[model samples]
Target chain A: MSAPTLPDLSGHFGRYGGRFVPEALVRALDELDAAYRTAKTDPEFQAQFKDLLLNYAGTPSLLYRAERLSARLGAEILLKREDLNHTGAHKVRNVLGQALLAKRMGKPRVIAETGAGQHGVASATAAALLDLECVVYMGETDTERQALNVARMRMLGATVVPVTNGSRTLKDALNEALRDWVASVDTTHYLLGTAAGPHPFPEIVRDFVGGIGIEARQQCLDQLGRLPDAVAACVGGGSNAIGIFHAFVPDESVQLYGFEAGGDGVATGRHAASITGGSSGVLHGARTYVLQDEDGQTVESHSISAGLDYPGVGPEHAWLHDTGRAEYEPVTDAEAMAAFQLLCRTEGIIPAIESAHALAGAARIVPALREELGRTPTIVVNLSGRGDKDVHTAGAYFGILDPVETLVPGENS
Target chain B: MSIAEIFAKARAEERALLIGCMPAGFPTVDDSIESMIAMHEAGCDVIEVELPYSDPVMDGPVIQKASDIALGRGVRTRDTLRIIEAVAGAGATVVLMTYWNPIEKYGVNAFARDLAAAGATGMITPDLIPDEAAEWIAASDEHRIDRTFLVSPSSTDERIAMTVAQCRGFVYATALMGVTGARTSVSSQAPDLVERVRHANPDMPVGVGLGVGNGAQAAEVAGFADGVIVGSALIRCVLDAPDRATGLSRLRALSAELAEGVRNPAK
Candidate 1:
């Protein structure tokens, strides 16, 4: 077979991907580009990483088949239990890899942009482990919604700066993070939450995330004697998808599907469906595809799930779609919410809204499997995190919880 | 080779796409299109028409204010596409330079088709990162719209080589470490930066932009680079002028001045 097309460093996946950063941050990027190459080869770093994942962060996270859900949906359901990860979610997996890379690069502090607070928590977790100063940029709005996460980051000794500018959301927080990074290019490393950003971030984060595929591929083979037919995951800056998609890319048999947040509906003016819907442009320092105006301003996105509400996606996804390696689709807010409730009832598993995108997509995929193949096929849905944190929003939507005015007895966290 | 031929002749000379900072719908869609026409008329390689966003942290005050005015005046994609059509009517090569959100809202493939139909040769969204380029780039390429990518000085030798290979038009070489602005001193390390680029790509023309102000700086940058890009300086000129003719004339004059500087950098 011909060699897989190597992704270029400008981060292009066949005309997508680029460094769209501020001028001040160029040196830092260059420094990172240089340090990452050296650090990747260091056995010491690898040994330390291996030790952390195995000991502190629980290596080889279990891939449990969702037998009941599979039977119910008429297709095999597998769970890549990233929830078993330390501090929950697959965000820590990336943070650990980057924080270690940062330590090797001799950076003083680690910076991050957070939405639902999972990334902030994970970054704080990594910083605490590595003894690095952590500064996580969170939007004021997000801080209000994910108050516990805000407090959690602070409790972990991280400085949480709420971004009050520009719609006061995740994207705005990202702008502030990039600004801080630009101002202090030398001493800080942006521990990006997802596989979005510029060249090295997409490539490096994907490398770190390949562990998921490695573990899952082996587990599937050991259990079922062959790789699963398809693997699906939620796309928020698309880290989980990258984590699951990397090892499977070379395996032509195992299909990869990434589900984006479609918000109220694709018909409505709300959603974060960048790959399935967005146009080509730049944001946060990479020229991939993003939701923007004809003038290049980032457009605001809406989703019931805050984590998957981001308007841009990773560049490699652009490459994948261009090359036809992976297929991306949007999962609407109602459908995701229904899936969220469905998972809670079916498997006693409450999933984060971002991960709910995968469940919602999987819900659709299950019915199609029976008609298409005439056999129930095994599939893995990366349960990225437990939905313990997003209970407030979930409760509000179903009217299970009260509005902000009068608090219930146990509502005061 | 001819200037237009150079841009078209991707194999020979490095194709450079020119992006101008003008408030969309400003001076009127007609005026904006005329400026695009003027850039093309004055031998600009490829036109990057910015859709002025209000909170453009990436841009300096000039482009930032232009973004505000354009966006504040409600210059939507429809208006910008009208401008693209007008520019194409003027027989100019054009592309859309914007952030990603609006395009995402518009739908990727539809946007690509609309842009290509409006006669846009390509797009330059500085913020659509590499990992997310799959849908937009793929759909656009299928529709025959080239996507331009940015390459910074901080980009490694390997990455620069990668960008030089992947990017369809010329590489946008940022001149300094800040947003686009007028600087008194041309980045002192510009010649060396140009030399470094030359070592990596002895072929492609690097468009030296950001921080370049006067003809002297332009000329100095031209000494080591292929083209001198003046954004804030020219935009500032248009904003300062009272009327359209004066602004257009000033734009032409600056273009000529910068071109002259490129020809004789020692001066």
Candidate 2:
């Protein structure tokens, strides 16, 4: 079969992605699509984007060989250190790209929807750097869970609005953002934070973050003289996973794996494993794998990692799963936390719980890879973010520190 | 009567039609059916039954609250069909309004077939546009049901024309560039957008929605448009009432006032 070419003009990834938004936003989507198309080929746009990635956001993040963890897991694991970026996550790359695009398009303001607040922080950072007005819509529950990130966003001169509707989580935040975008699309850009949502967004985000895969692909060729056996990344809306998987998609020898969040477990009916446990439907703006009831109402997704607690996965990941070019599995909260503690102890690396899902998934598949290869299997894992924001949650989970009571700052004081 | 026939009848009388909206199964399925019948008897020309969805992006807080109450009461997609059947049986011209996902989940063709069988004249899809509505368009045609796609103030001339061509019962004109809610004043953009839609297809009836509340606002919207669509304001009657009797009484009073407003168009 021919290599996969996706998101045809209509933004569909094999029936997985399309615009399911209101008519009020259509003109803005069209304008954005046109602007992105022009910017994609323009050398000036590329130069500006590249300059920021290299000098500001600090791209070409290190691809370190995790020998200690590899020894313990019986696999040669290479970690793509996206956590070391300026914003402590791979999300900064897409933020910077979109912020620059907003500037070029003459949109002075940007609005974003965030779940864990990492994307919100990254968006605020880029907005401050680009001198654009930024407003973030964060779920009320998330604002309490990730309070530090909220403060960080405020410090960057971004106004963070707490969304209180429907499940009070990521999906609600997304809905509120769309509502804002409808009224403000003329002067503001919806700087979507993932490789999901309508057409152009999935493609745009993948293109902006695809550098993770490009850099790692060359690093592997230089260090090991060949491609690794597998590439692993955590999939929420699947931005980081798609970021790392896009370049390796055509490399028939490299296996792509996306690890989704299994909150309690898939069997418990409370997990965020959209691709693994959900069915096909539309959410946010795209048709993808969604956790929904028989009546087509969206079901709330649960995950210890707030970033992965979304009911929908990116459309491309859904397409990839259907095409059998990639494999997805659920990493339960217990298993992810175990891998998280293990990484900190064995490798002295504190990974975001979202990224720990990748490490745990790699560990789960190592034995199978060993049996198949009859030798040490080389794997590249995308450490999508750092654990600085998750320290409190992790500490409480391990009983090292008492869980802090959530404070809304000005309320009930 | 069909939506087109109702529009024609209202036009012959030289007045716009008043369309009142409520979520199916708000509080409960049977209560919602009673609410629609009451609104119709009080003088709403058309009843727009919104299927309560979990994520209603286009709805403002008031409608969202009502929909949440409906979903919390276990209102399913099939329940919406039953509500539609009951409301239509009350001699009201009924239309179903929804986001695309529920219909997609119910199977587009199956939903179209069921909705037609249930006596809904057409569907008003706030989210689904003609650009991405091939499956729905085909299904709606095969089932002989009308499809109402919205045109917004932000819609370009080409897009408005394209969206108008795909519409059947009537073309919906979003008066403002915002979600569904009641505003203190009707949008300044509504008249211009209606004119644009008229330019696209003058013969196709245009129903203006979003931010319309109270008889005066309805009259102002009715002056220029063929239909004045009200959602959040009507749902608020039941939502804020102290009891069910109070809710129906308030609903009937408001519906009568709005009906009076539409009959006495400001134009």
Candidate 3:
């Protein structure tokens, strides 16, 4: 079979992705599209990107065999450890590439919208490294939830602006960031966090983050001597999943699963399962599956993981689901939390609640797979980030810290 | 009457047209309609009724806050149409300003039919452009509804020409490279952009928006452009008012001041 290619010249992934932004952003997007085209072919740009990945962000993250998880689930489970990367998530990979591209485009300032604050921290890290002025727009609620990451971004010299608009979450932050970009397009590059947004952004982010899939594909072959039966990743805006899913798209024998955050459950109408439970509509400059009411007004999505608390997914993910190239399912908050705690106890690896959704999804499918296959199947779950930032939330949810104890962490202990 | 007729009438009077914008159901549905009617009676030549969206990415903080209030109060597409119907019934040229998603969900043809039937003469889609607006273009043409497309300062000559060709009424010239808001100074790029749009299509009346606040700023924009569009400032007037009656009165006062400024450009 030939190689898998997507998002045609106009940035349509089978009618899913298009530039649905305002006229003010058209020229900037066009310029970005042209610059990315040039940068993609330029060997110097590629060399610089590779060097950063190797020495700075630390690419080729390990694919470890989760033996305990496999033994318990009756399937061979492998953990693609993206949590080990700089900034403790897969976000750094894309931020660095975009930061370098910004430099090449003669942009001196970088801005991004972050939800869980991982992308904000990662973008701030990239900006500090590149010496570009950085600003991050985060939802006010997110700043309160993910305080550590907010502090980390500020420490890295980024101005963290809290957005208190609609929903006060990722979607709202995205809106504010786009507003900033419209005003500052002359000197500021919007370091979009996910494989979403208008033309060139989805494609550009996917290419940069596709390193996860590229490295994982080779590492799986080297470690297991064969490809996994299925690869699962959590999907919010779907950057991390798309990152690892792109390289495997051409490999027809492999199955791809995207786990969306089911805040309560799809039936409860309080979930972020855009692909699973959403209808196709436009949001954040792309025509994708969005959680909207019958009138096309975007509905608020709830999730324990701030990163996955979005009403929309990447357009490519929508195309992938429509074309039957990939399957998307929801992992409820309870199920994801269980998997989060289980991974901590069994594998000694605490994952971001976002990544735990993938774990929960794999757990849900494994029992059925064992019954159907009559043999152990190999599964690789993308552990997209470490859980240090989520420890406070987890402690609260589990009631591990009392009210007085929570007041002072190290001091009380 | 068509948007061209409005501009032509303004030109005949030797004054740039003053276009007032306010979101539907802002503060409240009926109150918003009453406020817009008051502005129209005071001096607004054309009233642009904004269909408040869930995510208004193109709007500044003031408009965003107004839209949030509207949406929070349960304003929908049908309510916006109702507001437009009331405003148009009061003998003012009405145009609907909306983001694309709601229309896409509401069905382009259905929205066009409803908008036209409600007495709205035109539409200003902030997010939808000529390149990706084939559905809207066809629907608007079928309904004989004027379609106004935005042209930014950063637009290339080719882009300007393309947008001008698709525009049925005046081309919306975004005064600055930013989201919609009132500003102290008209962007230096506004005149150049208006010139570029004129060069592309001299017949197309150019309306400059996105930063015209008070009368002086309106006069500055009106000096070069055929129409002066005001939105955030009008919303702010109502937002800062002590009561609904005062808000409507303030909206009328601001509209009258801007209307006078458009007629008499500052030298």
List the TM values for chain B, per candidate.
0.84, 0.99, 0.98
Estimate candidate 2's alpha-carbon lDDT, on a 0 to 1 scale. 0.94
TM-score of each: 0.70, 0.98, 0.97
lDDT of 3 by residue, B36-83 (tens): 998899898999999999999989989889998988888888999999
- The alpha-carbon RMSD values of the candidates against the true structure, listed in the order shown, are 7.7, 3.9, 2.5
> Of the candidates shown, which would achieve the greatest TM-score relative to the real structure?
2
Interface RMSD of each: 4.7, 0.7, 0.7
Residue A83 lDDT, candidate 2, scale 0-100: 97
lDDT of 2 by residue, A367-404 (tens): 99999989999999999999998999899899989657
Off by over 4 Å in 3: A1-3, A403-413
lDDT of 1 at B181: 80
**Cα deviation in Å at residue A144, candidate 1?**
2.9
Q: Which model is ahead, 2 or 3, in terms of TM-score?
A: 2
Structure candidate 3, residue pairs in collision:
none
Candidate 3 docking band: high
lDDT of each: 0.76, 0.94, 0.92
lDDT per residue as tens, model 1, A1-413: 21134456555667666665543465577688888888779888888888888898896899988877777777789999988788878777799999998998888799999988889999998999899999999989999988999999999999999977667889878877776676466788999888878667887888787788889999999999999988999986888898888888898887789999998776676888988878776666665767765545677888888888888888888778767888889899889998899888888888887888898888788767667667777788888887888898899889988646777798798
Predicted complex 2: DockQ: 0.83
